[model samples]
Target: MLDANLKSQLKAYLERVTQPIEIVASLDDGAKSQELLGLLRDIQGLSSLITLRDDGTDARKPSFSLNRPGADISLRFAGIPLGHEFTSLVLALLQVGGHPSKESPDTLAQIAALQGNFVFETYFSLSCQNCPDVVQALNLMAVLNPNVKHVAIDGALFQEEVDARQVMAVPSVYLNGEPFGQGRMGVEEILAKVDASASTRQAEKLNAQAPFDVLVIGGGPAGAAAAIYAARKGIRTGVAAERFGGQVLDTLAIENFISVKETEGPKLASALEEHVKQYDVDIMNLQRAEQLIPGRDGALHEVRFAGGASLKAKALIIATGARWREMNVPGEQKYRNHGVAYCPHCDGPLFKGKRVAVIGGGNSGVEAAIDLAGIVSHVTLLEFDSKLRADAVLQRKLGSLPNVTVITEALTTEVTGDGRKVNGLSYKDRQSGDTRHIELEGIFVQIGLLPNSDWLKGAIELSPRGEVMVDARGETDLPGIFAAGDVTTTPYKQIIIAMGEGAKASLAAFDHLIRTSAPE
Candidate 1:
């Protein structure tokens, strides 16, 4: 039996629902034994019925079946539908129900006319918080046309599946059981891929042929700057990106960027985009570059986007930035923005007078905890390793802070909260083997960073930690190709550093052009 208040809330949520909803529960030994059956029955009573199954035989099995009654919607919960998971489930339901009204009928009809079923499976690590937008976009497409099915699998939980599928990074999407694309992509771009995949299978396809003077691979600060500069230099530049702003868009504020004392990430991106449009920059938003090969003369590069569009460029510049690494623990993704945050500068003010937890013992972690202690009511610093890896001065300063509690040998295992937001975290002491749960309103995760150069493969040399290698002038080992911004193996990854690298890379590209094409 479920509580009256919980049932009432669920009923209220289902009242406006206009589509089908389903929940798939895992019955593993370690799974929580809550009253989920009764809740499923209640959901069935409120909305159209859909198939649901127990993962008793195999936890990895995809058990939900869809029977379209003109418009069909479905929601699956692999584990206990509580905390952040419940919110995701509810939102997924609402999205499926409202998707038809959101898109035009002709577009929906065009999608439905496709003969073969297209299944898009997107693999995402819980730590990669930027992946939700991609998932939502695909899920909306799935909702509109029953021919399209979208499945989101947790990368860490399904490591064997990920290995078999050769999924090396987060936010990777597979179409029709084949590796379709990777990284964060938008709705229009995904639809284009779906259409291309369908057309290629039906008829003999020819290679793409498009020409441009310059091709910028990323749409971040450096990429945008390079495109604007090159366009102003009278070169026909084309900028292709999965999404504009790269990882910088995840930041809440740009405090250190020049000229702007404090600007939000979205605002800065908008301004950069406006400035780029002032020139002749051909912007291809929501497009991901799938491959890049040097041209015959070595001065030109052939770049192919995910949707099979090709562009030839005389110069190429890579400005892809880095993404924040995650602390792989349960509930971390579920509570993101609600209480779990990666940037202290972004969500610190919201925790005023509230207890907060800071994960990691590195310099960034210690500094963030110290800075947040002033704003929050209390700060708990949890470090998995034996000792703090921060500098001596920072360790001494943090040790002296009365409001900060440093717990060495502590490893966070789970984040616990109500359906809407985070409330606390559970951890275990490595040495003592004792588990403890701390009630808090916020958790800050600082586990270093991951560069966005995995897709480059061996085409360019990379540092020990996977950052692209660049010389003093931002020239990569590959001739006629340049690397810039945080993706490069630069000492600092600040906005000022990225901007300087952008300018250096542009100048280096110009010099390379001059040397190769002299009027000798």
Candidate 2:
């Protein structure tokens, strides 16, 4: 049931859609179809701009379509829209109504100039927040072009398709019945992968003869900050990264970003890239760094990529970030993006009115519990320690919530799920030597973080935990090289902290350059 506050919010969001959007429901005879139809009726009644129509003729499953008044669109959803995907559905309708696509002019022109026909089948789970972005991007491409066709499938509802295609994860994209890509990707990236002309030739390799004055590795917050600071000093700055936003793109909410009260991961990541473009940093994205070689005779240091392309720089700043730690237990890997997820900020909304569990008793777990308590029906937190490791203030807030339960000294045994999604979790309590299973729809694992420093294996001095060792000024054992962010021994992993460390590393590199020579 929609509350007054939510109804008001939906009303505001729908007011922006001035144009009328026609929805056609293609459903088979079943209880699931009835449920989906009921929800659609409720949504249609929310605003006069939404009009619902019945299409029982060519229906194979409980599917629906969104289009303009006269023409059908490429966007279709095969199953009930619930969890985080509800936002995707609303956005699709709004975009078809009046809201223009957010792609840049260059991106729109590229989509318009596409000559060949392409059909995209994207698989998704309702609880996955990352799946919506890819779906929305593909839908936008379809809206911008007439040759492209797109469909969003609920993986669980269509198990035969999942089994046949081996769809193991959400956002699993297929182009013309062949695997194109998986996971989160930008609109331009998806277009490039499907567009023939864009993928016909190899990218231009790097030139080793020319060297940059300073090269910043990784395109996360830390690397971006370093590149910006160094470029401000009029140095020839360059940055190489596998992706522009790094791990930030995987994050969901940003309540602790300072000054700004709240933000989403992708939004902040986009802004970060936009800000870095204002500088003179030579951005080389989608390139993974493999090896690092020290400079000879005070020449440029060499950084090698996977494809043998290499860059030469006088000084280097390593800001390679970290990824979320996994449970590594049974069902954890099998049910990723199905019922077990690593990011609460992105996937929390999908669990609204559903019971969920948070593993770990640290600040993150407690914070997750507190945040989820407002939306979900209940939150059960499991801690492997005798006492909670979170701050007293956090503990106080956690205790105040009515829908939260805390279990201490418990070891998570396994994540239990059906073949398609998670349903429960098994845990063993240390005190009583008892095993218990909790029936919940989702499990959030926030135990810790693992640095992405395995590639630097023997090249740099690393701690036992694989964190790079650096001094106060972010200088590593290798004199001309510096490390920052979670990859370094910078204590904590946070956006603001990483940004500050990046700035510090850039200044330290600038000081090193002055001691040697100007941007010679």
TM-score of each: 0.54, 0.75
lDDT of 1 by residue, 278-302 (tens): 8877776665666767665454677
Clashing residue pairs in candidate 2 are none
Q: Best-fitting candidate, measured by TM-score?
A: 2
Q: CA lDDT of each candidate?
A: 0.69, 0.82
Best by lDDT: 2
Cα RMSD for candidate 2?
5.6
Output the worst ten-in-a-row residue range by lDDT, candidate 1: 200-209
Question: What lDDT tens digits, residue by residue, belong to model 2 across residues 49-143?
Answer: 88898774534478887888765467788877676677778788778887877667867888878778788888887756578878888888777
Model 1, backbone clash pairs (residues 3+ apart or across chains), number: 0
